[model samples]
Target: MSRSEWQKSTFSGASNECVEVRVVDGTVELRESDAGDIVVRTTPPKFAKFLQGIKAGEFDHLTT
Candidate 1:
Protein backbone atom coordinates (compact mmCIF):
# COMPACT_ATOMS: atom_id res chain seq x y z
CA MET A 1 0.00 0.00 0.00
CA SER A 2 1.12 3.57 -0.63
CA ARG A 3 1.92 5.94 2.23
CA SER A 4 -0.97 8.13 1.20
CA GLU A 5 -3.40 5.25 1.56
CA TRP A 6 -2.87 4.70 5.28
CA GLN A 7 -4.66 6.77 7.90
CA LYS A 8 -3.89 7.05 11.61
CA SER A 9 -6.28 7.54 14.44
CA THR A 10 -7.00 11.14 15.37
CA PHE A 11 -6.59 10.24 19.04
CA SER A 12 -3.02 9.07 18.39
CA GLY A 13 -1.70 12.62 18.75
CA ALA A 14 2.07 12.12 18.53
CA SER A 15 1.97 8.79 20.31
CA ASN A 16 4.18 5.97 19.10
CA GLU A 17 1.56 3.42 20.02
CA CYS A 18 -1.48 4.01 17.89
CA VAL A 19 -3.83 2.26 15.52
CA GLU A 20 -3.83 2.84 11.77
CA VAL A 21 -6.27 1.88 9.08
CA ARG A 22 -6.26 1.52 5.32
CA VAL A 23 -8.99 0.72 2.88
CA VAL A 24 -8.21 -0.98 -0.39
CA ASP A 25 -10.66 -2.43 -2.85
CA GLY A 26 -13.51 -2.73 -0.37
CA THR A 27 -11.30 -4.37 2.26
CA VAL A 28 -10.18 -2.74 5.49
CA GLU A 29 -6.70 -3.14 6.90
CA LEU A 30 -5.76 -2.40 10.50
CA ARG A 31 -2.39 -2.28 12.16
CA GLU A 32 -0.73 -1.05 15.29
CA SER A 33 2.15 1.39 15.37
CA ASP A 34 4.03 -0.84 17.80
CA ALA A 35 3.61 -3.84 15.53
CA GLY A 36 3.70 -2.66 11.95
CA ASP A 37 4.39 -6.13 10.59
CA ILE A 38 1.10 -7.45 11.93
CA VAL A 39 -2.06 -6.54 10.10
CA VAL A 40 -5.73 -7.44 10.43
CA ARG A 41 -7.98 -7.37 7.39
CA THR A 42 -11.76 -7.45 7.26
CA THR A 43 -14.72 -6.57 5.12
CA PRO A 44 -16.43 -3.17 5.38
CA PRO A 45 -19.66 -4.63 6.68
CA LYS A 46 -17.90 -6.64 9.37
CA PHE A 47 -15.81 -3.66 10.33
CA ALA A 48 -18.89 -1.47 10.62
CA LYS A 49 -20.53 -4.03 12.87
CA PHE A 50 -17.44 -4.17 15.03
CA LEU A 51 -17.44 -0.39 15.34
CA GLN A 52 -21.10 -0.43 16.27
CA GLY A 53 -20.39 -2.97 18.99
CA ILE A 54 -17.59 -0.78 20.27
CA LYS A 55 -19.90 2.23 20.40
CA ALA A 56 -22.38 0.09 22.27
CA GLY A 57 -19.75 -0.86 24.89
CA GLU A 58 -19.65 -4.52 23.94
CA PHE A 59 -15.90 -4.66 24.41
CA ASP A 60 -15.66 -2.66 27.61
CA HIS A 61 -14.89 -5.72 29.67
CA LEU A 62 -11.72 -6.36 27.71
CA THR A 63 -10.18 -3.12 28.98
CA THR A 64 -11.41 -3.58 32.49
Candidate 2:
Protein backbone atom coordinates (compact mmCIF):
# COMPACT_ATOMS: atom_id res chain seq x y z
CA MET A 1 0.00 0.00 0.00
CA SER A 2 1.17 3.47 -0.73
CA ARG A 3 1.89 5.76 2.18
CA SER A 4 0.25 8.57 0.23
CA GLU A 5 -3.14 6.87 0.59
CA TRP A 6 -3.11 6.87 4.38
CA GLN A 7 -5.77 9.13 5.87
CA LYS A 8 -5.37 11.11 9.07
CA SER A 9 -7.89 10.32 11.77
CA THR A 10 -10.89 12.64 11.83
CA PHE A 11 -10.67 12.84 15.63
CA SER A 12 -7.44 14.77 15.25
CA GLY A 13 -9.29 17.99 14.53
CA ALA A 14 -7.29 21.18 15.13
CA SER A 15 -4.37 19.33 16.66
CA ASN A 16 -0.91 18.64 15.29
CA GLU A 17 -1.33 14.93 15.93
CA CYS A 18 1.50 12.46 15.75
CA VAL A 19 -0.17 9.38 14.37
CA GLU A 20 -1.88 8.02 11.26
CA VAL A 21 -3.10 4.61 10.24
CA ARG A 22 -4.09 2.69 7.13
CA VAL A 23 -5.94 -0.57 6.69
CA VAL A 24 -4.58 -2.62 3.82
CA ASP A 25 -4.33 -6.29 2.96
CA GLY A 26 -5.96 -7.31 6.26
CA THR A 27 -3.31 -5.56 8.33
CA VAL A 28 -3.14 -2.10 9.83
CA GLU A 29 -0.18 0.17 9.31
CA LEU A 30 0.58 2.94 11.80
CA ARG A 31 2.97 5.83 11.44
CA GLU A 32 3.85 9.27 12.65
CA SER A 33 1.87 11.45 10.29
CA ASP A 34 4.08 14.48 10.68
CA ALA A 35 7.43 12.75 10.99
CA GLY A 36 6.95 10.89 7.68
CA ASP A 37 8.43 7.60 6.43
CA ILE A 38 8.39 5.67 9.73
CA VAL A 39 5.79 2.90 10.11
CA VAL A 40 4.69 -0.06 12.18
CA ARG A 41 2.41 -2.83 10.96
CA THR A 42 0.13 -5.12 12.94
CA THR A 43 -2.36 -7.78 12.04
CA PRO A 44 -6.12 -7.27 12.49
CA PRO A 45 -6.24 -9.87 15.25
CA LYS A 46 -3.73 -8.05 17.41
CA PHE A 47 -5.44 -4.74 16.82
CA ALA A 48 -8.77 -6.25 17.80
CA LYS A 49 -7.29 -7.53 21.02
CA PHE A 50 -5.97 -4.10 21.81
CA LEU A 51 -9.38 -2.60 21.24
CA GLN A 52 -10.99 -5.23 23.43
CA GLY A 53 -8.57 -4.42 26.20
CA ILE A 54 -9.55 -0.79 25.95
CA LYS A 55 -13.25 -1.58 26.13
CA ALA A 56 -12.70 -3.80 29.13
CA GLY A 57 -10.88 -1.04 30.95
CA GLU A 58 -7.83 -3.17 31.46
CA PHE A 59 -5.65 -0.11 31.09
CA ASP A 60 -7.68 2.06 33.42
CA HIS A 61 -4.93 2.28 36.00
CA LEU A 62 -2.61 3.79 33.44
CA THR A 63 -5.00 6.71 33.06
CA THR A 64 -4.73 7.59 36.75
Candidate 3:
Protein backbone atom coordinates (compact mmCIF):
# COMPACT_ATOMS: atom_id res chain seq x y z
CA MET A 1 0.00 0.00 0.00
CA SER A 2 1.15 3.51 -0.68
CA ARG A 3 1.86 5.90 2.15
CA SER A 4 -1.08 8.11 3.03
CA GLU A 5 -0.90 11.81 3.67
CA TRP A 6 -2.10 12.46 7.19
CA GLN A 7 -4.16 15.58 7.82
CA LYS A 8 -4.64 17.48 11.03
CA SER A 9 -7.92 19.09 12.01
CA THR A 10 -8.29 22.70 10.83
CA PHE A 11 -8.94 23.65 14.44
CA SER A 12 -5.52 22.38 15.47
CA GLY A 13 -4.04 25.81 14.85
CA ALA A 14 -0.31 25.12 14.82
CA SER A 15 -0.44 22.71 17.73
CA ASN A 16 1.63 19.55 17.39
CA GLU A 17 -0.57 17.71 19.88
CA CYS A 18 -3.58 16.76 17.83
CA VAL A 19 -5.17 13.83 16.07
CA GLU A 20 -4.42 13.11 12.44
CA VAL A 21 -6.45 11.07 9.98
CA ARG A 22 -6.03 9.55 6.55
CA VAL A 23 -7.74 7.11 4.28
CA VAL A 24 -5.74 4.03 3.31
CA ASP A 25 -6.97 1.01 1.36
CA GLY A 26 -10.57 2.04 2.02
CA THR A 27 -9.94 2.19 5.73
CA VAL A 28 -9.86 5.26 7.91
CA GLU A 29 -6.50 5.62 9.61
CA LEU A 30 -5.97 7.66 12.72
CA ARG A 31 -2.98 8.65 14.77
CA GLU A 32 -1.79 11.28 17.14
CA SER A 33 0.55 13.94 15.79
CA ASP A 34 2.74 13.63 18.84
CA ALA A 35 2.96 9.84 18.38
CA GLY A 36 2.88 9.17 14.68
CA ASP A 37 4.33 5.71 14.98
CA ILE A 38 1.12 4.27 16.37
CA VAL A 39 -2.03 4.04 14.26
CA VAL A 40 -5.60 2.86 14.47
CA ARG A 41 -7.47 1.65 11.41
CA THR A 42 -11.22 1.33 11.00
CA THR A 43 -13.76 0.72 8.30
CA PRO A 44 -15.78 3.60 6.87
CA PRO A 45 -19.00 2.54 8.56
CA LYS A 46 -17.29 2.21 11.93
CA PHE A 47 -15.60 5.53 11.44
CA ALA A 48 -18.89 7.13 10.68
CA LYS A 49 -20.37 5.67 13.82
CA PHE A 50 -17.41 6.99 15.79
CA LEU A 51 -17.95 10.46 14.39
CA GLN A 52 -21.60 10.25 15.25
CA GLY A 53 -20.72 9.19 18.75
CA ILE A 54 -18.39 12.14 19.03
CA LYS A 55 -21.15 14.49 17.96
CA ALA A 56 -23.43 12.88 20.51
CA GLY A 57 -20.85 13.41 23.24
CA GLU A 58 -20.54 9.72 24.03
CA PHE A 59 -16.88 10.17 24.84
CA ASP A 60 -17.24 13.35 26.82
CA HIS A 61 -16.22 11.59 29.99
CA LEU A 62 -12.69 11.35 28.66
CA THR A 63 -12.31 15.10 28.75
CA THR A 64 -13.97 15.62 32.09
Candidate 4:
Protein backbone atom coordinates (compact mmCIF):
# COMPACT_ATOMS: atom_id res chain seq x y z
CA MET A 1 0.00 0.00 0.00
CA SER A 2 2.83 2.38 0.69
CA ARG A 3 4.34 3.94 -2.39
CA SER A 4 7.66 5.46 -3.45
CA GLU A 5 9.85 5.06 -0.39
CA TRP A 6 12.04 2.04 -0.90
CA GLN A 7 12.65 -0.27 2.04
CA LYS A 8 15.32 -2.91 2.27
CA SER A 9 13.93 -6.46 2.49
CA THR A 10 14.29 -8.20 5.84
CA PHE A 11 16.08 -11.00 4.01
CA SER A 12 18.95 -8.62 3.39
CA GLY A 13 19.67 -7.32 6.86
CA ALA A 14 23.08 -5.77 7.46
CA SER A 15 24.33 -6.74 4.02
CA ASN A 16 26.15 -4.39 1.67
CA GLU A 17 24.11 -5.77 -1.23
CA CYS A 18 20.44 -5.57 -0.41
CA VAL A 19 17.12 -5.86 -2.16
CA GLU A 20 14.92 -2.78 -1.92
CA VAL A 21 11.25 -2.72 -2.78
CA ARG A 22 8.30 -0.38 -3.02
CA VAL A 23 4.87 -0.14 -4.58
CA VAL A 24 3.88 2.40 -7.22
CA ASP A 25 0.58 2.74 -9.03
CA GLY A 26 -0.50 -0.74 -7.95
CA THR A 27 2.69 -2.38 -9.21
CA VAL A 28 5.60 -3.65 -7.17
CA GLU A 29 8.98 -2.12 -7.87
CA LEU A 30 12.23 -3.75 -6.90
CA ARG A 31 15.89 -2.77 -7.16
CA GLU A 32 19.23 -3.50 -5.68
CA SER A 33 20.29 -0.95 -3.07
CA ASP A 34 23.69 -0.79 -4.73
CA ALA A 35 22.10 -0.12 -8.12
CA GLY A 36 19.18 2.16 -7.42
CA ASP A 37 19.00 3.43 -10.97
CA ILE A 38 17.72 0.14 -12.33
CA VAL A 39 14.27 -1.12 -11.39
CA VAL A 40 12.07 -4.11 -12.12
CA ARG A 41 8.30 -3.76 -12.05
CA THR A 42 5.72 -6.50 -11.78
CA THR A 43 2.24 -7.14 -10.53
CA PRO A 44 1.79 -8.11 -6.90
CA PRO A 45 0.65 -11.60 -7.83
CA LYS A 46 3.70 -12.15 -9.98
CA PHE A 47 5.99 -10.85 -7.30
CA ALA A 48 4.43 -13.21 -4.81
CA LYS A 49 5.01 -16.07 -7.18
CA PHE A 50 8.62 -15.04 -7.56
CA LEU A 51 9.07 -15.08 -3.81
CA GLN A 52 7.50 -18.49 -3.63
CA GLY A 53 9.91 -19.73 -6.24
CA ILE A 54 12.81 -18.44 -4.23
CA LYS A 55 11.54 -20.14 -1.11
CA ALA A 56 11.04 -23.38 -3.05
CA GLY A 57 14.64 -23.32 -4.23
CA GLU A 58 13.67 -22.99 -7.87
CA PHE A 59 16.43 -20.45 -8.21
CA ASP A 60 19.10 -22.07 -6.09
CA HIS A 61 21.38 -22.75 -9.03
CA LEU A 62 21.86 -19.05 -9.60
CA THR A 63 23.29 -18.54 -6.13
CA THR A 64 25.04 -21.89 -5.86
List lDDT for all candidates, in order. 0.86, 0.78, 0.94, 0.90
In the range 1-64, model 1's lDDT, one tens digit per residue, is: 4333778978889887988888877789999888999999999899999999999999999986
Best by lDDT: 3
Q: Give me candidate 1's TM-score against the actual structure.
A: 0.86
Steric clash pairs (candidate 1): none
**Candidate 3 error regions (>4 Å):** none
Preferred candidate (TM-score higher): 3 or 4: 3
**lDDT (Cα, tens digit) per residue for candidate 4, span 1-64:** 4578888867788885988889998999999888989999999999999999999999999985
lDDT of 2 by residue, 3-51 (tens): 3467776888766565777787777888886767788889988978977
lDDT of 3 by residue, 5-38 (tens): 9999899999999999999889999999999999
For model 3, where is the 10-residue window of minimal lDDT?
A: 1-10
Name the candidate, 1 or 2, with the larger TM-score value. 1
Shift of residue 36 alpha carbon in model 3, Å: 0.2
| Candidate achieving higher lDDT, 1 or 4 | 4
The whole-model C-alpha lDDT of candidate 2 against the native structure comes to 0.78
Angstrom error of the Cα, residue 33, model 4: value is 0.5
The predicted structure with the larger TM-score, 1 or 3, is 3
Arrange candidates by TM-score, descending. 3, 1, 4, 2
User: How do all models score by TM-score?
Assistant: 0.86, 0.62, 0.91, 0.84
Stretches of model 1 off by over 4 angstroms after superposition: 1-4
User: What lDDT does model 3 reach?
Assistant: 0.94
Return the top candidate by TM-score.
Answer: 3
